[model samples]
Target: MELAAGNLSEGNASGPKPPAPEPRPLYGIDVENFITLVLFGLIFAFGVLGNSLVITVLARSKPGKPRSTTNLFILNLSIADLAYLLFCIPFQATVYALPTWVLGAFICRFTHYFFTVSMLVSIFTLAAMSVDRYVAIVHLRRSSSLRVSRNTLLGLGFIWALSIAMASPVAYHYSLFHLEVSNQTFCWEQWPNQGHKKAYVVCTFVFGYLLPLLLICFCYAKEIRDDQKSFYSFMPNGQSLRGCVPFIRCHTMIKNCSIIQFLNNHKVN
Candidate 1:
């Protein structure tokens, strides 16, 4: 009697007839993509505008004007920054928006190669400039001969050569990563041997970070010891370590920031 009563009360009484509701796939704004786009866009825009202005100012000089070694380095630095801004940021933004690497392999290799090279060149040039500034203040008399020898241009050429050597590996190793689950692609480096990746990363760290910091310190220490007091040294404590500390701290901060930005964007693991 109870079983008959139960069957009568329920709509489906053949078996366990009520089915679980299937979950609906979410369709909404992806916060990660949105944030990435916003940040990348601002960086791209500002980099282009600022670097372009720097390049232009350095490139166009008065008819009788001669550029200083610092100006030359500043010019090179601007060029590198400009190239990085043009090559990496836009394409990176492209991939973030797209589902895959639709532009194909040639660009996949060259874009990253150029970007890496430019970043290296920028960091190197900045370090070179710090050294040049040290020379100017400490050895102003000798700098006249260095200026005549066109050492700045020569140094710039050397920096570019070294940068290319450091960045060339990207051409061979970087490619699109196809994520099976999401059916999406990412630009990444896949090293054939893990040792190669480790070596490359270590090299980048030492050359890009450690060496630059050391150079900045050496330059500033030389500057402090020159004993060439200037009008700017108004305060007795003005020429102290606190004043010169920024040369080490700030310059390293810039180098570390640049290298970190490149490595972060590269997604190098």
Candidate 2:
């Protein structure tokens, strides 16, 4: 006992022992990650609920009542949004919450693939809807036969097939790999060259955003111009101009919002 005590005393005397590190607080969290998770959770909940409702209403239309072409487009849009919410949000949330990807290679690929596919489908659907509206309003007599259910269904199928084909590169490029230095696994696109990666980003932005945006804008602008011409002729003393102000402003606001959202989403990815 004495020898043990003497040894303990000598050990203590060998300079004051370094202080022990304080235990981490039990409730501690990364504030940024916490906030991100909360926001993503809210988005996922609202998106799923809203899209599900839209799909349900569209799907349950009374039997023998022919579905409108617009309803078909909206239904397709809702399904794409639902798919995005269900398949993409959880995995994307994990990206912000976890330090490294724990999901396997297939999930990593599928998540990115489906994300791109859904985004493309959504934007393309919007473009198609804009064109349909323009045709119905501006070229009514000329395009009457083209705006039928059969054509709409065919168009929706084409959209899905094109979206899937366009998003194929993501599945091919994204992969899970182990990093020796970080001692962690990550799911990322492994491009052969930096230039190729940039090219792909540029290509996706152009096809997914730029082209669709231009098409929507052109269709709406032409429709608005035609409507305004007829509307002004019917109204007295420029009353039509006043009436169009609010609509023009609303259109501008919506356009700005869409642009902002697309930019933000791309930045996040």
Candidate 3:
């Protein structure tokens, strides 16, 4: 009986364990992903159409005519956003709809580079437009000549150059890598030194955000103080910036809230 018991125990030990349970499919998430993809697709579609309209109108205007400083900055900002809507948004929708990074390695690098550059350009252009408004409002006599077409073009060029310089470093660390375990590809910044990424973040925060924001605040504040004295001072140059009335009004209001208050300041009404 003892020998039989020992043989039975050995047989039990040698018996195959139940096969490991299969990985469960994430059922509910597919529905969520589909919703997300649809929303992004709509956003991408509308953004492309709107930005293209702005671009076409601005680019088609007479070459030699003077572009307003505000117009110039808006044009540049639109271009940046256009590039983003064209490249990044569609790719995002694709990834949300599918399981893999179907756009490939080259696109991984290119998209990130394009995204960073466009973001930098948009912010820089906004800060520039704020400066233009400040100058236009605060130092009307002093800056009127400076706001002319030649200078506006130069300012636009400078903004583009600065954006390129600031965003160029993002490309250095950006790359595509394949994961062995997942058998998948991803875009990531591969900085040689661990601190390199931290350094880049710091730089972007300081120059891209902090410094530009502070400068905008300082300039706009100065404008507010000066603009209080001069109300309804907008003298439209011959060019009307075809499709930019609403855009100009919104941004200009931020810099010239003092001008807005002037309506209340008037006792005549």
Candidate 4:
């Protein structure tokens, strides 16, 4: 009895033991990250599936058909998007989920480099497609001379080379850095100075955004103007919908192409 009382007293003296803490989640989760993850997942699924289908269809195109230049441009675009979706999306999505860069220096640099390269490839390919369309529609006779498999392939090679070269600076500029306050590491660009950073931004803006925008806009605008003029001249004024049908049919192709190019450029930017 005495020992039992002493044990009880000892237990009371020690006070109630604290409850074990609930296990922490493997990763931090919040509304913002949750939404981002969901969005990335959807994009990954749809983008991968769509791009894969396009590539497969294009690859299996009727043998000996000599795929059109537009098809070639589209194939390159799909390839670029596939590369972007495959390589960049996974790493990029991590930025929202994690607070630090855990992948190390090489992946950091490569991801950034390839991100820019893929984007430029897609954008440039869209620009090339616009030019091809302009040539095919506006200068029909010349298109026969200008649009050939060899030239399309050469253009694709140039786009890839230019993208790789232009994006090379990113690989050199990006590196892993430690944050003393957070005790975390981050992948970021380490420019030599503010001026260099500004210059890079300006250059990227001009080459990646402005030039492509100008080229696409110019090609489409000219094509539309020329088509409108041709349509107006072909159809008598005050004619029936039958007369309007031809213009509408012609404009529909241009409109669809414009929308597609604009959406692609928007995505790249």
Candidate 5:
């Protein structure tokens, strides 16, 4: 009877149990999403208005007039900024607000592609602007032929084409994934692979931040050097124009007069 009870107890303990936990909760959506929507909306509005003004100013100004390369850069930067604000930001805001990509699979793919392309183009254009400034100030003589308007346009076109190519993978991989949670349906990226996320972050930092910062630093350094040389060469007759002002004259006269009075007082003593 004891042996029989032991067998029964062992059987009860080994009875079928719950299965292991399955993959769940691929993404999170919450109040922060609402805040993101508001912030993105404001950014979109301001970017659109500012870029539109830049475009209008660039278009109304005459072309082929040997304008500053900086102006051309501003025009192209405005175009890229406008594209991001108008084409990308609204779609992103919608996605964040809905918390599920209600937009179809095609839109999901294309929207991601468009956002990436705009981002790349914007940064590359800024880099080009830095290079233009560097050439203009560091090698002013050589810059005359190199900084033509047509060349700037061509460079912008190339930047756009390269950006599109870089962003093509986004169109290829993105898809909507549906999940079940307590009888509710949730949609998110089909596969949030760690490797892909890491790659994206690294690529963004390299192209978006590091490279552009280096270019900006180079441009500013060249500008400072050129300005220093120009200023030294233009100084008048080994005397600083800044130091030869009426203020300095008055101070010098007061010092000389005080010295003369002190000398007279000493002689009287």
Candidate 6:
């Protein structure tokens, strides 16, 4: 009886407890580093060249004053892209190459803020450009009479302000953290013990991805619909309208016929 009790106690004590798994390094870290380097180089080269050209043209062009609102928006967009390339790219490239952030907490926080602000600015500028294109193409008459210069400037100001506001959290929350197992450093947001990390991810995706995508889609759809309407208005009898096509026929057939006719006419010459 004593031997059985001892064996039973040993068995109970030996019952499985979860073993700590070996820590694994993040996947694709090397590939990500290479990509970051390439992107940084390209961004630096093109951003500097393109932005310089924009500024030079805007400054020297004597087109009897800037009549188009698009010029201003393009100039602003280039400036934002250049700023991001110059300020953010180098730091990001360094982080990727080293795979460890040796920078102090303050620098990390400030750099993160700059990166986020520039990204937000770029996205918002693209959104503004989409709106500008939609207005120009879809509401040509109304666009002509609009005081676009003043409104565009105001819009740019608002975009920058909003971008700064969105990026403030990075400056506030980012910190340099050391992981002993990996023996590497990371610059990440230091959230409260609660579910702050999840909240941040959700917010980032909603504002950064979802909202921008929806805005771009809405603007593009409007532009396409307006273009189709304009084409039908100019066409005789609206026979060329795409909606008139029978559902059973392939759309490519119509496109192929037009191409074949063009080719035949050219060959005859």
lDDT of 1 by residue, 126-224 (tens): 778668767666777776666542778888999999989988888989887778998876777789887878788878878866787689778867876
Q: Where is the poorest 10-residue window by lDDT in model 1?
A: 231-240
lDDT for each candidate structure = 0.72, 0.75, 0.67, 0.73, 0.63, 0.65
lDDT of 5 at 216: 69
* Greater-TM-score candidate between 3 and 5: 3
Query: For candidate 3, which ten residues in a row score worst on lDDT?
Result: 260-269
For residues 1-269, could you state the per-residue lDDT of candidate 5 as single tens digits? 99999999999999998899754432445666767777888877876887798789776755555545556666776777687677767776776666456667777677667766766776676678668767766777887788887899888889989888876756776676665553422323333475775575566556655677688677767777777554322222343424323432442343234334323322311
Model 6: weakest 10-residue lDDT segment is: 247-256
Please identify model 2 stretches exceeding 4 Å from their true place.
Answer: 1-28, 228-269
TM-score of each: 0.76, 0.75, 0.73, 0.74, 0.65, 0.64
Clashing pairs in 3: none
Report the C-alpha lDDT of model 2 over 227-262, residue by residue, as the tens digit: 855433332233333543453354345444544544
Q: What RMSD does each model have against the real structure? A: 7.4, 9.4, 13.1, 11.0, 22.4, 16.4
Say which candidate scores most in lDDT.
2
**Per-residue lDDT of 163 in model 4:** 86
Candidate 4 — which residues are off by over 4 angstroms? Answer: 1-27, 228-269
Estimate the TM-score for candidate 6.
Answer: 0.64
Error of 4 at 66 (Å): 0.4
* Per-residue lDDT of 64 in model 1: 79
User: Whole-model lDDT for model 1 versus the true structure?
Assistant: 0.72
Model 6 C-alpha lDDT per residue in residues 1-269, reported as the tens digit of each score: 99999999999999998889755535545665667678778867876886788767755655665535656666676676667667766776777778688867877777767766766766676677668767766787787656367888898899999889976866887788899999998886666643665565557557754687589779879877879565323213333324322311332232234234323322311
Question: For all candidates, what are the clash counts?
Answer: 0, 0, 0, 0, 0, 0
Candidate 3: where is the Cα deviation over 4 Å? 1-29, 60-64, 229-235, 238-269
What is the per-residue lDDT of model 4 for residues 110-228, given as tens digits with 9 covering 90 to 100? 88788778767777777787787678668867878889889999999999999899878779988898989989998877776767666666686678767887998898798778785
Score candidate 6 by lDDT.
0.65
Cα deviation of 116, candidate 5, in Å: 1.5
